[model samples]
Structures are given as structure tokens and as C-alpha cells.
Target: MDEFERHGIAVVEGRDAAARALRSPELTSDPGLGSPSVLLRDGDGHARVRGVLREIIATLEPFPDAVRADVETVVDALGTSFDLVRDFARPVAGLVTAAVLGVPLDDVFLDHLEATTANLDVFGGTDRQGQASAFRLSVQLSRAPAEPGSGLAALRAAHAAGRLDDDELAINPVVLAHAAYENSLNFLASAGLSLASGVARTSARDLAAEICPARYVLRFGSEGPVAISLTDGLPFGLGRHACPGSGVALAEAEIALRALADVLSGGCRVEDVRWKTHPVFRGLASARVLVSV
Candidate 1:
């Protein structure tokens, strides 16, 4: 609240007002970086890039058998005691992010992706480290060899077909990967905290609504900036800029959480729980869940 007050930004609370603010044509999601990333664009450019992304995401619509198996493998390998953020949620989220981009992401890539949260800061592109991380990821993706059916390949094809410009092609792939990873990473870790603490099992959709990891989304209007609270069952957002990868997020959570539940079914003790301080993305930084064998 002080942040908003300092910036002269309004706080759009409540489900109705937030919804209205999200849907209002008077507001725009772009934070003035002038980047080609879809998240920072509105109007036809956003739609065009978003359409390409939507098509790429469609490949995992039913949550592919391979992805499920990979998630299961990760879950099965979990030791009795592990940091849920590192051992469980991070790997699961990384795998899905890799699948989304059709490129295997390494620890470095995940580290940079995590750091890119600065790129999404509502204050705009003032975070130099965040900008550097995003730039590095863009460079890394540009040189990556993607198979024909991969998301990167699909993006290239779109560019070849003139659907996306050169700048869009270079950056949007990173944007796609970031979008797919960040919230899921946060949500999965937070949800694991709930499960480890003996909360009742809930569907992924319900859990997401409850956790609302991406706590607030910013929009600018003629008046000023407004931070809209998404905790009111608006986790995936509303209106034109709503998360394009929402379906994938839910599917990924369903599979990963189901596997996590099985691992914890024998009971567990959660310890050293910690939370990240970022006002926008809500998540745990560390939580050790010691499972009973």
C-alpha cells in the first residue's frame, strides 16, 4: 500500500472493482518499456503474438503423456526430507517450462528466469539485474536448437510467415517461457506448503484461486497506475491481458500436485518455512517437508 501511495498508484481491491479495472479500455498493461514482449503490449500486436503462443501451448492441451511421466519421475525420486521449493516445485515447474519452450532448460536458465521477475516490476524497467537476466535469456534462446514441433520452432515459423517481426521473434520466446514458469513455480511451492501443513487436498483450480500466487497485476490509465488485487479468485487475471498459459498452468499443477499428495500421504512435518517478500508474486522461498516413510 505504501508502494502504491509513493507512486501515486491506486489500489483496486474487491472482486468487482478489480474486474472492472482489468476490463476497462481506459487502462493498459504496458509499462512503457516499448519491448516487443506480448506482456508489455496491447491491441493488435498483443493479439498477434498471443495467438502464436496460444497455438504453441495447444500441443499440451491434454497435458501430454510424456509430461505427466516426467512429473511423476521427479516426484518419485523425492527423498523423505527435502525443500519443497527446490526438490519438488522448482524441478516440476522447470520441466513444464522446458516443455513449453520445447528446449531443455538448465539450472542457469531457471536462475535467470527467476531473476527476471525484476522485468515485471510494476515500477517499469529500472531493475538493471532483471533487465540483464532477460537479455541473457533472450540471447540463449536465440541460439538454442529447437526441434520442428517445438515452441521455439513454432515461433520461428511465425516469424518466417511474417506474423511476428524480428524483434518479436527474438524476445517473445523468452517471454513465453517466463510466463509459463514464474507463476507456476510460485503457486506450486505455496500449494506444497499448504499440503505439507496438512491442509485438505483441493483441486488445482481451487488451490490457485486460494493461493493466487501472482497477487497483483498493474495497469495504467490516464489517471495513473493501479495495482489490481488478483487474490479474489482472479489469479489468472481478467480481460485481454489475462494469462495466456492458464490452461497449461492448471494442468501442470494437477499432475504435479497429485504426485506430491501421494508422496506426502504418509504424513509429513513442515519446518523452516519462509516466504518471498515480493509484493506482486506471492510464494515461499523455502519450506522443508519431512515425509514419514
Candidate 2:
């Protein structure tokens, strides 16, 4: 809130107001984050880039059997005690992200992806490290090789077909990866905390609505910047820029969390629960869950 205040950005609260604000043509996503990225564009540009992304995301629509197996494998490997973020959420989310890009992402790639969260700060004027992380990931993805049916290859194909220009092709893959990873990562970890803390069984959709990991999204309009709350039943966002990967996120969470529930069916203990202070993206920094075998 102080960050927005410092930047003279107004906040729109409550479900109705935020929904109206998100749906308003007068309000638009901020462009300062980067050019040619779907999150930073509106109208034709946004639609074009977003369409490409939507198509890429559709590949995982039914939550591919391969992806489900991968998530289950990770969960099954969980020892008696583990950090949910690292051992569970990170790997599960990371595998899905890798599947999205059709490439293997190392810890370094995940580390940089995590760092890029700081770049999402609308008030990132003084955050050089965050800016550098974003830039590095962009550069890294630019040079990354893509397999035949991969997301990166799809973007390159779109560029080749002239649907996306050079700049859009270069940056949007990273945007797609970040979009696919960040929320799922945070949501999975937080949801795991809820489960470990004895929260009753709930659907993945309910868990998402409850956690609302990406707390707020910023938009610019005639009156200037307005921070819209996603916590108000708008977790996947509300309009043209709504998360295209929402289905994938929900499916991933459902599979992973279900497996986690089985792992903890005998009960568990949650320790050292710590939350990240990112204003826009809310998540746990770390939480250790010791399960009873």
C-alpha cells in the first residue's frame, strides 16, 4: 500500500469495484515492465500475443497424462519431512513450467524465475537486482533451444508466421514461463500450509480462491495507476488479460495437492511457516511439513 501511495497509484478494493475496474477499457496493464510482453500490452498487441500464448497453453488443457505422472512422482518421493516450497511445490511447479517451455529448467533457471518476481513490482524503480534477473531470464530464454512441440518452438513458429514480431517472440516466452510458474508455485506452497495445518479437504479451485496468491494486479487509466485486488474472487483475473494458464494451474494443483493429502493422511506438523512480503504476489517463503509415516 505504501509503495502504491509513494507512486501515486490508487487502489480499487472489493469484488465489484475491482471487477468493474478490471473490465474497464479505461484501465490497462502497466507498460513499464517490458514491451511486447502480453502482461504489459493492451488491445491488438495484447490480443495477438495472448492468442499465441493461449494456443500454447491449450496443449496442456486436459492436464496431460505425462504432467500428472510427473507431479505424482515428485509427491511420492517426498520424505517424512520436507520443505513444501522446495521439495514439493517448487519441483511440481517447475516441472509444469518446463513442460510448458519443452525444456529442462535447472535450479539456476528456477532461482532466476523466482528473482524475476521482484521485477513485477510496479514500483521497481530502485530494484536493480530484480531488473537484472528479468533481463537475464529473457536473455537465457532467447538462446534456449526448443523441441518440436514445445512452447518456445510455438512462439518461434508464430514469429516465423509473422503473428509475433522479433521483440514479442524474444520476450513473451519468458513471460509465458513466469506466468505458468509463479502463481502455481506460491499457491501450491500456501495451499500445502493449509493442508498441513489441518484445513479440511477442499477443491483446488476453492484453495485458489482462498489463497489468492497473486494478491493484486496493477492497471493504468485516465486517473493514473489503480491496483486491483485479485483476492476478491478474481484470482485468475477478470478480463482479456485474465490468466490463460488457469486451467493448467488448477489441474496441476489438484493433482499435486491430492497426492500431498495422501502423503499426509496420517497427519503432520507444520513448522517455521514464513511468508513472502511481495505485495503483488503473496506466498510462503518456506514451511517445513513433517508427515507421519
User: What's the count of clashing pairs in each model shown?
Assistant: 0, 0
Model 2 error, position 136 (Å): 1.6
Clashing pairs in 2: none
The regions of model 2 sitting more than 4 angstroms off are 30-34
Number of clashes found in candidate 1:
0
Candidate 1 per-residue C-alpha lDDT over 75-133 given as tens digits, one digit per residue, 9 for 90 to 100: 98998999989999899999999998899998999999999863356575467887789
Worst 10 residues of 2 by lDDT: 117-126
Provide the TM-score for each candidate, comma-separated. Answer: 0.97, 0.97
- Candidate 2 residues 102-200, lDDT tens each? 899999999988887532665456777766888898889888888999988998899999999988887787788888889999999999999999999
**For each candidate, what is the lDDT?**
0.88, 0.88
